[model samples]
Target: MPKADSKFISCKPSKHGSTLEGLAPSTVLKHSLLILFCKDPSTEEPSVSGAETGIFDASRSFHSQRSLIEQQTKDSLQVEKELHLAKSQLLSKKIEDLRREECRCLLLKRRGTELACQILASKSEIDALEARHQAAECEYRQREIEELEEKEKTRDEFYNLRMSELEEFKESIRRFLLDNRDKVQKLQDSVSENTCDLLAMQLVLCNVMPMQLKSTLNLLQGSDGYMDNGRIAAAETKKSELLAEKEKLEKYLISSDHLRTLLQKKLHKMLISQDKKKTKALTKDQVEK
Candidate 1:
């Protein structure tokens, strides 16, 4: 087998030399076959068998290497496809996240716009309410002023009427006092005249009769003595009537004084009440101002 392999290598030295210089596999295979044919017919069998065996081994090695390269290419393509799919999925996820963020931002902007509009509306409503309140206050103040003026006018009218009535009462009281004084003076003059008349009668009686026998003579008197007794009784009755009239006049004067004091007290109270009302009104006006 070794001698046959040596002979086969010697037979194809030039062809093998060309094959080693990077020739195509078909060219190398053609060169090998030509060398095999050109061998002596007596040595052909063993050389042909050795060349065929080497050709078969070379063909098997080429087929195995081709299959290994195809499998490596398929595995690389699969890996590239997987990486591309992963990248696509990652890009899609990023796009989805961005879309969600945009939606959230838009929602926030819309909410902010709605809130701004609500604030403006609230401000306008507050301004309108304030205007209405101011107007109501003005109307209330006007009504209060009118009412106060009416009350003051009524009070003045009432005070004037009361003053007129009080003046009339004072005038009537003065006239009553003046009339009582005249009556009292007249009564005094009458009492004095009656006293003088009584004294004259007493003197005449003393001259006409002894003091011890005066009572006895008056008791046993005839017609002239009886007349003198009647005159004395009439004078005493007149004096008693005058004293009763004087007492009645004194009572009337005292009642009139009490009535005047009560009127004065009532007037003073009314004045105090009016002053209080005035002070209250002034204070109220100041507060309103």
Candidate 2:
């Protein structure tokens, strides 16, 4: 019923325009004729009058039916046009909704691409930083290794020098012992003879002492057998002292060699530990990057 009423309103103006051409005059003429017919009766026979009244009633009923049909036709046309307009508006709204949805989908795709690009860039930077950190760690480890090697080399050289000096001192002691052996043997022979004057004459005969000694030598020349008495023993004592010092230095060198070996082992272990530590640190830094 509401739909039908809305249709009537929409058709009111057009119907009014069309009806203005003839409907208004026709309605006035029809009403005027009805009034005239009601006022005046026929002047024919009574039977004719009754027939005339019936005819007038039939004509009035036909005009009312025609006017009702016209109103119904206008109402139907208005209802159809209103329905069409509503359908067009619904279709437009649906199209607009679809367009908005399409725009939203496009925006979502663009944002996804942007996020992917950002992730890729971040990953690239992280990789680069990790590589640089590993390189720096490697450089630092190499330097530590070089420094350890240098220190060990210097220590070895020092030990070698000390050993060489000890060997040289040992050789000097051996030579001194050899020279003293001869002097001690000769002195023992002379003292076994028990001839002070015989030794003096033997010294002159053997030309062991110079016939004309310098004044400084004459003052200390204890009858030409000075070296045959205590000189050999004194020289042996001095040589033994020097040999002791050389022996002590040799012992120290041996101890130092042992220490060097221990140091080498320790250094090797430390280097391995350092390598492990550096590797772990590099891995951590890479992950952080």
Candidate 3:
């Protein structure tokens, strides 16, 4: 029996590859020999008690180690979950920032495009306006030049007409003076011939014939009539000279009228030129504004 106890006490818990066989709880309680071993009546059977104590100790150590491992695993899992949530949040924020930047860039690009279009439209409008202004200026200058030429032409025409009229009036006065001079010379010659005939008749006979005397007296009467006519002709000549002087004055007046017309035309041209200058200045001012 002592040999059997020693053999049972030497048995160790399962730490090796194969398990050692043991009795069931019901079997051990029912057996009388097993009960004697738990009592440990003899001090020499202490190894036998050590066997049971070792088994209890090994089970408690295993349970404690398992609990520690389970708690450590739970903590690690919680930390990992927290880290993953943080990463997800950071990525979401980054995506939102990228979307906002893209939206801002698109808006800026659209604004730039609109500004370019507006600049182009304004440039085109300015070009068209400048072209219209240039055309108007050209047309205005052409009209001004034509008006000046027409005015000069009219001045020359009026001057020429006045000159022709003056020449015609001078010629008429000269003809009238020549005709009056010819008539006066003819009357003077007839009076001188009658005086010579009367002197010859007195020398030839103391008494002249009655009929001849009557004819001589009639000649004297005719000479008197001619002298009256000469006086009237001299008065008419003075009248003609006065009329010629009046006509000359009238011709000078017509020339004055033509000169006045020319002066008016020049003044009108000057006014037009001033207007053109003002228009050009106004156009420049508007462009600057």
C-alpha lDDT score of every prediction, in listed order: 0.64, 0.58, 0.59
Where in model 2 is the C-alpha error above 4 Å?
1-80, 158-289
Worst 10 residues of 2 by lDDT: 4-13
Best-to-worst ranking by lDDT:
1, 3, 2
For each predicted model, how many residue pairs clash, with residues at least 3 apart or on different chains?
0, 0, 0
Misplaced by over 4 Å in model 1 are 1-77, 191-289
RMSD of each: 11.3, 21.3, 18.8
Error of 3 at 215 (Å): 35
Q: Write the per-residue lDDT of candidate 1 for residues 178-281, one digit (tens) a residue.
A: 77557655655655555555456556545643543465456548555554656557655764665575566555555655655665576577567656756765
Candidate 1's error at 11, in angstroms? 24
**Which candidate number has the best lDDT?**
1
Better of 1 and 2 by TM-score: 1
Evaluated against the true structure, the overall lDDT of model 3 is 0.59
Writing each residue's lDDT as its tens digit, candidate 2 over 203-227 gives 5534632433343245447566354
Deviation from native of the Cα of residue 228 in model 2, angstroms: 47
lDDT measured at residue 153 in model 3 versus the true structure, 0 to 100: 84
